[model samples]
Target: MSDIAAEFDFSMRSHGIALEMQQSNYLNNRICRPLVSAQATLVLESANADLLWDQLRRVAYVPGCSKRLAGTNWPDPQVVADELSAFISQAEVYYRAGEETSGPSAALQYYYSLLNLAKAELLLWRPDAIINQKLTHGVSAVHATGNFEDWRVKPQRGGVFPLLYEKRMGVPSSHLPGEINPDQLFSRCLESGMEYIQVRGKTLQAVPLYQTIVTDGTYSWSHLLIEGYGVIQQNKPSWDLVREIFEELPPLHHGNPWQVFALSSRLSLDSFALLIPCDGKYVRSGDGIHIGNLRLPEWEEELAARLRPMLGHPHGYFDGTLTVSLSDSEFVGLTSDLARYLSVYLVSSLIRYRPSALDLRLNPDQAWYLAAFTRQAALPALQSAANEILDNEFVFLDRVRG
Candidate 1:
């Protein structure tokens, strides 16, 4: 019944088609040869079986209704815009470097990147297609994590870059044939979030990161960490301060109102992924697919040692008898700065993936930790970046004050 209901739901979602649900026993009683006909609805034997009828009757098939639902986890348009710009810049640089084969390869990559950008734009216009849309640029996904070697090939599962590249290089690509109109696609992308500028009386697009790059001889997010460390040391933020900071930060308004994870006693340094909690359940989240567990970096031992004193340790946090929470013990010794940065970064990442109120035994100090990070590092950096990303008249602080 659930499987049938889910299929019906998908049909309604994608094609705006509706399915009528009728009781199985009703068919069995009405039809002379009921055994020959398979039932669309399941038959349950119980005193409370009438309740199931109520559920079936209430299954509403409203076209495009989900669009009105708040907190849909749509990918940030700004990230896509910035990355496409970065790729274009890299391509231009490579093409001009006078390298024999490197120039053509970069040019080809840029071409593919533009097509992917168009596809992303199409998704924005047809929001219903977002769930089914596969990522077009694998490289962009790899770039975000900063762990290139591990994530480089991963995006290929949902992206076309690798197969297309291989085919272009005479590697014999075995894929479906789907061509696009470049002019129309580019126009659509412009309608989405792709920005441009005028160069020598000609319109040119693909200037990276809101057209204002911050070159600090480090990764763009590096300052968040550096500032987080420095600010944590200089300021003694109280819980009250933390609460105020939380209220200021944007709320998670997407799918999955709640995520519950019961911890286990098992612990290991070899694994960067969170341990599977026996009683773990993702409530209200769609599908809840565990995508091979999220990869978190192993913090420096010195930093972890610095954070050990302030952390709490409670036994039985996990299902088994344990001295402390598995994550807490594993995450022990983080420097206050690193901890602060991680808390904020992790929260943002979680919210981006599927915004939810987390109910987990691991690292319960995340709330206060996030508060401190927001007060010290997040707000300041966000404000500065917002000033650059937005026009002079619409700075983040001005909006916040308003």
Candidate 2:
């Protein structure tokens, strides 16, 4: 357990640096400093080991955490605290020897409980972090990312984790990155024992320090869908295959016949393109379709009309053309459904065709935008669509296959 702790701690440090939270000395003094300075000692003092243990057991009520600790329980904190001189010592032993490959251990359970108790205490002063964030447990894992365990404190690819602990703690922030006091935030992380790990610029760790306060595992179907997509996105080659599947799919609505295009060569510069019926010559504009060499103001309105549903109020400037971006919440919310509806097709299409021609690859926003489409169950719907496309194509099969 000590070895694992050491490794996990090391992972936390390395990941924090990679994420530019601790590595950039500038952030510590600027943003993290003030955050950490907002101490929760009084709260922690009020909640002792027994209270902490109870808080951890309460996690069974949390949706995601309950799922992880399926059939696990830890002893009362008083029992362990009375037996051992120090919590860390017994925690180390129980944590190390308690679990095998199959399931979670009592030690692991206690460790999480203690961590959450600390965070829950902090939440007393910094309620912003947990206010309406719907954070479950301090740790989570789904098969899609090939992570049986997710212990990072924040998300990778530019989110508030190591830099601003509040966001990772489920507290959203209005401040930009590196704009807050770094020193206090770093101090708070040390105080709370939260670990934010990133590998090769990817966030691999995000352990929610407060989630251990409960023991509930029930979750919504949406959570399961995202997990499914995470697994589907694991296959690199399948991205391109997903595009092919799109091309071969029949119209989502048979009478509408406005299914997305299959080949990259047939796409337009808008966020997405659909195969519209034309006599022979291509027609760009229609009731719903807005296309042409329009002025910036007109284009902006058109773009807003297209984006308003997904991004509430679309805001952007024209860099020779109209540009738009989604907030983190907006991106996740929109992408989650997109992935379920289009499945890999939406992801593959983005990879195959860019919203703008100048862009070389999917930007951070775009990549994450596509990530929402990774649901495995959606694949069957796509396959059914493909069969319909095949049935239509066979009527026009120019070349015979053996």
Minimum summed lDDT over a 10-residue window in model 2 is located at: 218-227
Model 1: per-residue Cα lDDT over 192-252, one tens digit each: 1122111112221111000000111111100000101222222333222222222211111
RMSD of each: 27.9, 28.0
Count of backbone collisions within predicted model 1 = 8
lDDT of 2: 0.22
Candidate 2: where is the Cα deviation over 4 Å?
1-35, 38-140, 144-402
| TM-score per candidate | 0.16, 0.17
Give the Å error, residue 66, model 2. Answer: 30
* Candidate 1 stretches greater than 4 Å from native: 1-345, 351-362, 375-378, 390-402
